[model samples]
Target: MTLTLSHIKKTFNGFTALDDVTLTAPQNQTTVILGPSGSGKSTLLRCANLLEKPDSGTLTIDEESIGFPARLSAGQIRKIRALSSMVFQSFNLFPNLSVIDNITLGPVRVNGQSKQEAQDAAKSLLDKVGLADKADAYPLQLSGGQQQRVAIARALAMNPRYLLFDEPTSALDPELEHEVTKVMAALSAEDASLVVVTHNLRFARKTADKIVFLEHGNIRFDGPADAFFDSDDPRIRQFLSIYDD
Candidate 1:
């Protein structure tokens, strides 16, 4: 397993977000977390990255447990975080900074790489996402799709082992959304380990190697993408019906 969530549980003010959720995300494959609103899909993804701390249970990266002030040193925790990159629903690019700056910030600040080295890396990543020409353009100057592509480039600049995408295309227009999806598809093609939280069933079916349907904080089904849509389980069937053809 590239990532494992064992008995992971989290709650906020007595409202449970994740209920003893257990998952084994395979390496070199896209594993999707799919569910309706309030299904704890985003929460689960946040927990894996320690963005939201779970009340109980363990999160392991390649079999090594990690968290704040427990099972890992501060430096080790930072390193672990660097090993995984996350792209949010909203493009979290630095509005004031140019595209290249947004991509170079992490390597220069977190990893202590020289500005020249970071710039070179960021440039390559921007090119990979088809934004090399927009290097000097500010985030506000770009289109929604362009900003999201830059966000993807920023995450890749970190050289992470795995990538987590949380509704990466939800904020774009249909045409722009298609562009972002193509970038995501390209990432999955190049790197097998990609974890995503999305409501796009077409994306789930086309890109996911395994799909885990989440409901009320519990996993209702964990199987191949086709099996999930074709599941005999009534809950799975009913839930999918909302998005089914």
Candidate 2:
């Protein structure tokens, strides 16, 4: 299984955010998108799940192309979304809901899963994210990391073929960041296909099977994580300086 985006181009008021961006993410591995701010990393990740429609592109899951620009029927759009679930950096939990409730809402509402069915699956995901005890806790009661893990669990509850992360650890403190990355590391070991947009170079190096670098709304490098680090590209070298490494 794979997720492929080809010839993707997006513009708002004619300001291109992604220009001819093409990426292929194969199954059972992690692909990281790296770039400085305004380099279009988030936009690219958003397009993968149709959260942001590409002005022109062919997004395919497995082998079927789902055109972003085409006026897709509701069913087609739902089918497209079902194939990938997005995890945001902010956690995006409902403040009024308990952790379990937040995780179960999507499956129960969007997937038409009964409450019991959703809860059953959510319990397993809770354990997987090390949040089995936080199920009944409100988002306000949890740390940023715990809340983010709940978000990850919420995405996993859908049992999607791919999980797309938009800088999942960006909002957490370094200690808290470890909590989220640990969960992601466990996910990477499974059959899950992950496409992450992140500025955390250390985490990217640790979890990424493949690294893709973007610059000025264009992709500059695509290769193994180690190779990307060893690249002669000055732009990539400059990124290393941004962090303490």
Candidate 3:
């Protein structure tokens, strides 16, 4: 399976955020987008799922174009979005909803599954994410890692072909981050396609199948994980130096 982005460009007012950005994410692998702040990594992820629409680009999944040659209708965009689900940096769980509700709402509301069906799916997903016992708990009741896992489950409830993570562990402490990173590593073992935007070098080194480095909204490096870290490229070395601290 593949998700391809061709010549994507996004602009805000007069500022160009993503300039001719293009890349492909393959099935059952992690493609980590790395860059410093304002480097458009997040913008790239947002464009892939249409959270922020690209001014110009072709988005294709599994070799089929999502919308091409013509602008998409709102319904078409939603249909395309369902093909891949996104998990945010901050756990965007509904505070008023219980864990099971947070996980089941998408399948029930978006996928038209029965409540029981949704609950069953949520149950399986919770087990997968190691949050089965917290099904009845509220968001405030869990740690950041637990909430992020719930977020992952909610994304899975839609049965997406690809999962997008935006700085998945940026908000958590190191210990909590490790917990979530293990879950991410587990997902990769299951051949779950993932696209992540992150700066956590240790996690990226361990989890990424490929690394795509961006600077000033353009991809500067795209290669295997080890090569990216071992390269003598000044930009890559300079950016990585901060982690030495």
- Count of clashing residue pairs in every prediction: 2, 0, 0
Which residues of candidate 3, in runs, are more than 4 Å off? 63-70
* lDDT tens readout by residue for model 3, 1-245: 79888888888898988899888998889999999999899999988888887888888886458543466788877777898999999989999999999998888888899999999989999999988899999999999999999999999899999999999999999999988888988998788999999888887888899999998989999889889989999988999998523
Model 2 quality (TM-score): 0.95
- Model 1 residue runs over 4 Å out of place are 67-73
User: Against the unseen true structure, what C-alpha lDDT does each candidate score?
Assistant: 0.86, 0.89, 0.89
TM-score between candidate 1 and the true structure: 0.94
Which tens-of-lDDT digit does each residue in 46-147 have in candidate 2? 988888889998999965577768887788778878889999988889999999999999899899999999999999999999989988999999999999
In terms of lDDT, which candidate is stronger, 1 or 3?
Answer: 3
**TM-scores of all predicted structures:** 0.94, 0.95, 0.95
